[model samples]
Target chain A: MALKGNLSDFSIIQLLNLITLAKKTGALYIESSSKSARLIFREGKLVYATAGMDAMPLIKIMARSKLIPSSMAASLSERYRSLNDMELGITLINSGYLTQDQIFTGITDFFKDIIRGLFTLTDGLFHFEAEEPPPLTSIPLRMTLEDIIIEGSRQAHEHEDLKSEIPSLDVALKFAERPGVNIRDINLNAEEWRVISYVSPKNSIKQIAVVAKLNDFQIRRVVYNLLQAGLVELIRLNNPAAPAPPRMIPARNPVEQRNLVNRVIDRIKTI
Target chain B: MQTQTVKIVVTGPFNAGKTELIRSVSEIEVVNTEKKVTSESEKVKNSTTVAMDFGRITVDNDLVLFLFGTPGQKRFDFMWEILSEGMLGFIVLVDSTRPETFREARGILETFRAYAPTPYIVVANKQDLTDAWSLEDIRVALRLDSAIKLLPCTAKKKSSVKTVLLELLYAILEELDSAKS
Candidate 1:
């Protein structure tokens, strides 16, 4: 038998807490309007997680995080496309390309990413089955559900802060010119510098996220911090009266529209 | 002469072949953010694009076209808006077999028209399928205007995809020439 309920009836945090307290091992399946994912737990600890097609793969995430070159990640995916998630992780580890610590850290971040991605869902179906999930290959990842719940709450609060500062990730951003500020005085980390390199008035935060390989939340946080320090500025390009593309001819006249279609059809027949 | 780069957005509803169109036409490897389908969409395809698909192709030596494919679901419309910015033109690829998707494509087209008033064409994709609607039938079903260009294409065929691209390019070039005058 499986335990199931709407998220409205029982919040994800409370549900996970109850599972943690009871130390039940099972898999939790969550489904929303446009997204769904599964979290595999062992003795109340999350050992693995996977989501619907809207979510990128762990290999893509790793490449985005700069942990591995995108080419290497692509090759790994092509070579292990058929392997299950845990099996692929084990293969990568056995191949000596990834350390066990790296996989553990990666899996942990993946859990948080899924949690954060679906944190805003107030209504969704969840099924918790007390079945033994496939073993996580050689390295077992055991994450404290309580810690994840707490971290999720914290990030939700940060998301609220970002919501007010940045209108939308679609808004274009550009580096602000500083007349008096010394460049060397401000200590910039490599990731921050990399984010800076992609900033342009033409590139929206979403585009920057793609090039930077970071998730939207991570990129937005960087931009927020940069804005507060007067290092970047937002460009508003909302034009309500932008011209519509010129029509070939008015289609209101049925005779003219029919004639145009007929001529095109005749030309196509000849071709 | 300066290289003129045109950003064209390829969009439509679920399983409309936006990603396949870009993949078939792009010179560069398409960068896609797709994951396994786990919802009602699973009935349509195994995987769905979550973010956007990106590719590039050079046209006529001087024109470099950047192709961006929007996620099919309306939930990811924010990405569509983002991709539509400064785009020269766009193509809405509809799956002819699914009338519901044609409706979905219409909604997307309306939303995109309001966002970016660029020239667009209605691409009836998956035409190789026996059940696919004819161009005339699709036009009537979509309630498409005579002014809009409707092209039937098999998204998987590179030559067919290239033809669609060429037609869109001609439309865009016409729009650009008129804008200058």
Candidate 2:
């Protein structure tokens, strides 16, 4: 039950429960472009966690060894404001509140769990890039680079199909060279975006045909547009039956439902 | 590039427990001005940030987060454009206690579909109330998208709160995966 993947795939909370379900114990290292967090679990329970920024003290210690304005860190510490834990450490270092070493001290002091890998599960690093307004840093953590690769690979794979399906889509994607495609100007509408988002190699034309509410020819046209944009990778599905799960859900009676609402309202009024 | 910061707005139409959910799991005290929210101000409150609450939680100290709760009223819908854009994802709260909340719930649901369709989770809050509504019932009432995972929740409980947040993060990441593929 304790599965592993990028932070882009699972949230820490759900991952914990999955681990809790399996009663697993291991170290999970989750990374994105800027930083990494490691969670250590012992028999399904969390013990400690830390991130690459935990190495900041090592950075500050190095920066001080290099004399990169020790006061620069102290001055910026006061102006930093954010709700993210990992960002605080970065903000400190970038804002000049603490030298890379000072913030690293703060990170290790608080993020010791991340550095120690106390969790009993091992999850891969996510490689997500954060776009924000902030100052720059001199020395980056070693783990951050690995994440960037994973995320980049992830992006490249998603849009491969539409690129191949529609030659036009291929051109736009190559020309644009960005994650999102602008079918808005191309008369493709939002429904097209829905279909475009699902053009993975795992899904075939038929599977998409069922969900898209669009015909195969229409889908191909949309896929063609996507192909020109390099937004998807159209492929054939080997397991057509693997698509939709059965609807074990029961149908409801309209009168029973409205009656229930009325009774709940009456009860509330009485209250 | 560096680690990305996810600025998430957890909102729904009125009476959806947006504040309660925040209160349950927030490591820091969540600022709540609950009195500012009610049936009367539903028309013109156009986003007072009633509980424009703030909190922090460290996860292995790698993920930095900013949690925002917006009032769930049609009037406040305007602020959604500002809050939804640039957000990592969203967790939409659904009120299980009152069925009438569906109209507003549907409005926000459509907003998410039309605007912030990336990765989002739906929470069926107030599982503790007497005559508790079933999960299936809430889903049907809300007519939620099949892909959206709606977890039964009593935002006051730590376990419930934690699971909801986890599912929410999962949804966002999954959306990223879909986009990547």
Candidate 3:
């Protein structure tokens, strides 16, 4: 069965832990407003990873790392255009252009980079398709996710802290009333200034993220700092459709409610 | 003599075994409106409740308890508000073996809280499974308040179901007692 959830509810650390503990073979697809990533696993170990619509080809990665001459890389790319990444890597190793260790190292580093970038995303949707095969065009590796999970745990904790402070991205921000500190006296960074420019009760933190070209974690961090400094305050937009607090009991009188509950308890005890 | 009825809601994420929980304890046949699951993502279960599951127990000749299980999908969230009206208490069930649904369970709990300030308990179902998360881990993952009761349960067992109901009833009784004095 497929497993899916929002990142806000399950952090990447938890997801990796589950994958490792369960020894699951699957492709975990993660997507946010700005980017999407796919990490394929075999028997709970990461095998391959690709981010965005256009991932850099293996040959480019190899040549960029100076393991192979750029001229040879261009020639190989044209000659092996029809071959998938795995096939091309094999051909390169067989042709003595690059060592097996060199190819594996280059792909492993690429996978790490993609996964590390994913750690910074605090909000997104993730779906795990069990037993799904890796892409034919991608070069697969067999690296344990333990190291990556250990590294990402700290970021996950920071994300959790930020999330607790500002629970919802739907919440808008506005300048605090009666600021304890002068706005002019406080120093704000470029990103913070950009976020401040979009501060309005009409614009949600999510909208600000898009306009300011900041990711979920980045935007939340800046807004959190602004809040801590008393430069801004959260504005919960009026949701007229939100459910009203329910009456304590269908019965109107507190005495009646108490008696009713006592009777139910008595009945339940008999069951 | 007129019969007095009280409503109690059983809610959680999709496939947390709401139907089985009610079936284990409901004296009357549960009136369920379930449909074959058409969504690819939810095909883990062959069918899902589209509307609601209604069960009843006769406390006595004069008192009856109505158990309403809300549908588990996001599309049916509106029904949660409708079914939660005037509920004396609630039970939030989580499939302990599947951590993926914990977030959805938290969302359901938050929605119910917004609708009412009633007493509720979170049940970690499927505890019989070897892979089921410990109650402590589930509680921390869901970020439940320390005071909130986190009970282990296997929904198919009548005794297990009874324990959950009794705990909820006790919580309700305690809430009422607090209100009185």
Residues B47-156, model 2: lDDT tens digits: 33543656555432334456778766676556666666656567888767654565467678777656655567788788777645566545654556567698888877
Question: Candidate 3 docking category?
Answer: acceptable
Query: Best by TM-score, which number?
Result: 3
A1-271: candidate 2 lDDT, tens digit per residue: 1133443323343344444444445655566544566555555544444455353333344244444365753443334433243565565467664566654443334443343331212234432121221123322221222232244334334434544444232121222345365645455578677776666555665566568766444565666666566555444323224322222212334354334323322322321
Fnat of candidate 2, please? 0.00
The runs of at least 3 residues in candidate 1 whose Cα sits more than 4 Å from the true structure, single-residue gaps closed, are: A1-271, B1-4, B60-63, B177-181
Residue B164 lDDT in candidate 2:
75
Backbone clashes, candidate 3: 0
Error of 3 at A267 (Å): 13
| TM-score of the A chain in model 3 | 0.64
Model 1: TM-score, first chain: 0.51
TM-score of each: 0.40, 0.37, 0.55
Stretches of model 3 off by over 4 angstroms after superposition: A4-14, A30-34, A52-56, A64-72, A75-98, A120-127, A135-140, A167-190, A200-216, A227-271, B1-24, B28-101, B106-181
* Candidate 1 chain A weakest ten by summed lDDT: A246-255
Using lDDT, give the best candidate's number: 3
Provide chain B TM-scores across all predictions: 0.91, 0.83, 0.98
Q: How good is the docking of model 2, by CAPRI class?
A: incorrect
